[model samples]
Target: MTRPIIGRVAPEQWRSTGATAPGQRTVGEPGTARIAVDLLGGDHAPAVVVDGALRAVQDDPSLHLILVGPAEATDAVFAALEPAQRHRITVVLGDSAVRAVAEGRADAVVSAGDTAVTVVSATRALGCWPGVRRPPLAAVLPTATGHLVLLDVGSTVDPDAETLAVHARLGAAYATAVHDVPEPRVGLLTIGTEPGKGDRLRRAMPRRLAGLPRYIGLVEGHDVVLGEAADVVVTDGFTGNVLLKALEASYSRLGGPESTRAAVLLGVKGVVVVCHGAATGADLAGGIAFAADLHRRAAIAAIVTSLSDNPVLTYNEVSHD
Candidate 1:
């Protein structure tokens, strides 16, 4: 199938009806959040996606949804809701979810569809922050102490040291802004804590990350669950994705702290949440809820503010091996 053309709406026109200006922090009615969901996303689309959308509205009275997909699929959601609840939903027949956000029809987007598609669409529609060549997907994982942010989970699989360094800065800002960590300790994930332990990419990261205020050297895989070494763990997308899925599966069978089965895309101008393609109704609902929470809290704006306050070193500025 051909990729959908996104970003038809110009950036200046984003949220024409909202009180806030484009690219500014979005402030909506207290507790009110409008999230656009991609109904055709996920392996078991429309069906599970419809179920998730219903669950989300039922759970949050102040939450609004913009369902993007075929009429038949969205009809399922409408059928499942009461007349009074139906007003909370807005239907967009066959449009990309990201487009709804860019067009100012939705506050955020949730998709269990193709990761690459969602990332590309969001980057085009919302644009990226300054110096972010490739955006990273940041996932919050529950740890023994509390929770730590794990980033680059399937965004740039073959990232360079420079990309990883950028993600480290992004993760630090996310932990500070969203998790409320006063001073986030950033760590590079590698095979061992010893110097020069990991692959070529890992070995090259310390030099790139040296300027970061809270760089904590290398961390082992176990450090992810322990949460002792750092508040934010940075890795290339390939390793982060594999580690995240493995831990999710382990937690599922062995019973561990319940972590959201969703990841938020960082470095973009808008709030976008992504779930696994095989996500269930409950997972999709969680993703939708997660997106809503981010919108209500003005997370993107806060993170951007944090980054602006403490500027991250750009990849071009640092010397390469």
Candidate 2:
């Protein structure tokens, strides 16, 4: 069986730095993962961020959080923590959070602010993989059948034909890396399964994605719910995000998965997760866990390797080009 890394932090020196929450100490353990939380990125700002950080520390002994935002908010989080438990938490400025990952200060980043800002900051800070022009956000949804991979959930809204093709490659690689699915089947999301159903972008993708990886023909909205047509489903951000939210709402009404709050930012240099802008403490906690899971599994690195190994077909060389 494939033994995936499920979010274990690395061993590092424990440093209290500067925290005045009574018994504040540092619990730096070997294999401890330090996550940088974006305090001002969510709708609720510092309040939810504070609650989530505390919950994360309480749930995992080896987890540490670098609260990134205004000092006042982070201080509030520290104030609420018991002095002894405070050792596991650190407060970093928001501007420094992305840099912390690039500078080797944090293992992963979770943000719920403007999706565009997070994407830009992460891409600029962490950098995108080679040939990854438009990075896609890949979300994992639990279907009645099984877990499904959906890409471009909130990134690349105005993607071109080439961009959709690139997302297909990234999604397939992600499935192989994280889902451990060999030769992952890819499906292009369209309004209907019939030929020429979607706009120009969708029509152009099938021909390009074919023969690259295990590209299946066009799949409709129902395919995403069924989870049988493809292991990785590709769509533009506008459609994907709306569909995801609608489905999530439906699932909430009918009661599907217990938790659905984590999504990996694919095509970037490092692992990053974008949770719901209105995520609760528990939802944020789930995002943290998901980020950790990706880090341990080396999902992003593995996907990069796969993409490199199997480069996308050049423009001129493509069949319909």
Candidate 3:
């Protein structure tokens, strides 16, 4: 089905309307964040999503939701909210929550859907930043000292050196923009801290990361957990995803600081947060809050500006042996 073209609205021209026209952009009052929630995106759809949406709206007074899913599911959300609170929600009557952002109906999107689908939809609808072939999902994990940014957490599984290089820059920029880290340290995750310890991809990374400032060389798995070595850890999506899940499980069983179950899809034009398929209502709510925070901070735009301002971060394709 061909979707209608939606005209983009300038930030200054944004206004709130009770009902949105096709392709007509709507914005809430100042300081209001409109987040599009995917009601059917998780393993436990509507039920958990409804709970999460209600929780988010109740907690954040400035939040407005554009619920996207089946009528019955979205209706569940509306039914749960109070008569006055119901005014904060707008229904999309479709599955793609990312589409709401692309159409300027929402400031950000939160989906627990398939990672591949979210990545593809975001790339197609919102578009990718320059030099980004495959956008990487960057998750922030609580480290011993503070939080660290981990990238390619299930976005690009079989990435080349150039892809990881792009992710490294993205992760660094994300750390600085979101975490307020100064000259964030970027590290390549591998089996050992030694230079020649990892596989072909790890071995090829040093050359690719030549000009990245504050890159402190190869970091081991412990470095990711300890947070002593680097502020941003870069790796292939497969490895990063597995590591994040393992850590989450460990934190659940043993007593430790919890890792974030949701990740922000970087290198894309808009703020899109992805939660795990089996995410709980609390997790989904956290993801929605994360999206709202990023949107409010203008984090994506700041990251893009940081990248554009830094001459060293420009991606250059190099032949890998």
Candidate 4:
């Protein structure tokens, strides 16, 4: 595909382009999206991340990447970019890039590094949203019927009922805001759809979700691919992580629609996107775009407001051991 031309959009252009969202502030300027890239996060490290950054910049004129890693990797990215494209990219030397946001450098973060490190660093740098305990990684998969939201894909492996319920709220907000689903359906992903079919956590979560809007009751693993049960599916980090990987593999072998290799970190104050340990340049580009999408939609703020619960209860609900 031909690369999209990059240029700064004017204020009048934003209004004339019909790209404004309802009830959101509109700057008649180009949609500039700043992404923080972990130069050392992926399996391919600086090399693959650089490749992806280059692709993202080339694809979106308003896209800017902040390479977070060694100075050497940042230098490499500059060398690869054309003189003009180089202006769209910046480099920061550090253990993480969340600081870039604090410094007014970046709008979102993307990492293929360790999940735990990313979460902790983000919590320290961006702070957690009210009622956000274990910020889960939420992925959007193209299902047979439409796109589906899967959460805790790799963030909270062993989660409690409260964690799952909070994730449900977060996921529902994401679906409504970013996915544009009206009254999005939320489902608890379990081994079976029957009552008391899943493990202890699943059994307890269905009851908790009853009070929440758009909750559609229990769903099975097959429901994920079918996309008939719910728009948002909640599970513990361990199961969600494993299930996503397995489904990705199956799709690879069986040849299904191209699904994204990135998952968004939900419940954090700042937007963070995570990719698989083994990600391609395309996957990284998608992750960057995903971050941009979330930013444009102001998804996190919308979700947090809808939760209507005390942020402290988010952690208190779960036993973090």
Using all chains and alpha carbons, the TM-scores for the candidates as numbered come to 0.87, 0.86, 0.89, 0.84
Stretches of candidate 3 off by over 4 Å are: 1-24, 75-81, 314-321
Q: What is candidate 2's lDDT per residue for 64-132, written digit by digit as tens? A: 777666545554555566756657776643453565576667778888778888889889989876667
- 105-201: candidate 4 lDDT, tens digit per residue: 5678899888889888888788777667789899998789988999989888888777777788788877866777767888888777677787777
What's the C-alpha lDDT at position 11 in model 2?
A: 22
Total clashing pairs for each candidate: 0, 10, 0, 5
lDDT by residue (1-321, candidate 1, tens digit) is: 121233332223321122333345454578798888987999999888878987898999888777777655555544565656556665445558897788676789999999999999999999988778789999999999999999989999999888888889889989988989866999999998888799999998999888888899999899999999999999999999999999999989899989999999998889999999999999999999999999988999888777767655333432233
Task: Tell me, by lDDT, which candidate is best.
Answer: 1
Ranking by lDDT: 1, 3, 4, 2
lDDT of 3 by residue, 122-161 (tens): 9999998767889999999988898899888999999998
Please identify which of the two predictions, 3 or 4, would achieve the higher lDDT against the true structure. 3
Using lDDT as the measure, name the better of candidate 2 and candidate 3. Answer: 3
RMSD of each: 5.9, 7.9, 5.6, 8.4
Which pairs clash in the backbone of model 4? Answer: 6-61, 11-28, 131-311, 156-237, 157-238
* Greater-lDDT candidate between 1 and 4: 1
**For each candidate, what is the lDDT?**
0.82, 0.74, 0.81, 0.74
Please identify model 4 stretches exceeding 4 Å from their true place.
Answer: 1-30, 308-321
